[model samples]
Target: MKLFDFNKYFPDEKACRKAFKEMRDREGVVCQHCGSHDVVWLESKQQYQCKHCRHRTTLRSGTVMHGSKLPFMYWFIAMHLLTATKKSISAAELQRQLGHKRYQRLVTKQEHP
Candidate 1:
């Protein structure tokens, strides 16, 4: 898809988050603490509560975005660019495209976790 279409599909942070949650739901969420698959989404808290253990897990807990402070849109955009592009794009180029002020933060977020 084109950049315009990508932007239209993910117009805001909420849209991106909702999309992520839908994908996660399809794959199913397993409780990290109790090792159970009985999890339900808590819309008010934006987390999953394990029915068996009562443990709360954030949407990003086991995903690529885990422990990262960047917005969901950033991850979506980065994924789109990385997969859609014919040529390999550098991290610096991605940072510039995202209009992020610091490259170190992006590198740290991508590399550390």
Candidate 2:
């Protein structure tokens, strides 16, 4: 089961942003137009606007749940618990934790990458 404590997953925005940044930086973002790694972060917008192409890319772009219904915090909690537990949690477990019956249907009905 998720058994996630939201406070544990997203205790603060800074922590969440730091974790997200680390993951995002693991494979540094490259400009789609020029293949340049140089970029700048816009705090107000929370997106990276490539210094090369000036393209605006969202932190959530191209992620596994790009268009999924799962909240970012929930996803983060799920991932953390799954990794920490080192055991696969079933949909029913996640469904219970999420408190959304529709999630079970979505998890079952949709395909995951």
Best candidate according to lDDT:
1
Candidate 1: tens digits of C-alpha lDDT, residues 43-97: 9999999999899999988888887888998999988999889999998898898
Q: Write the residue-wise lDDT of candidate 2 on 11-77 in tens digits.
A: 7656766677678878787665677789887889988888878997777665665456555666666
Clash-forming residue pairs, model 1: none
| Candidate 2 Cα errors over 4 Å, as ranges | 1-9, 12-14, 104-113
Local error of candidate 2 at residue 28 (angstroms): 1.1
Question: In model 1, which runs have C-alpha deviations exceeding 4 angstroms?
Answer: 108-113
What TM-score would you give candidate 2 relative to the actual structure? 0.70
Report how far off residue 109 is in candidate 2 (Å): 12
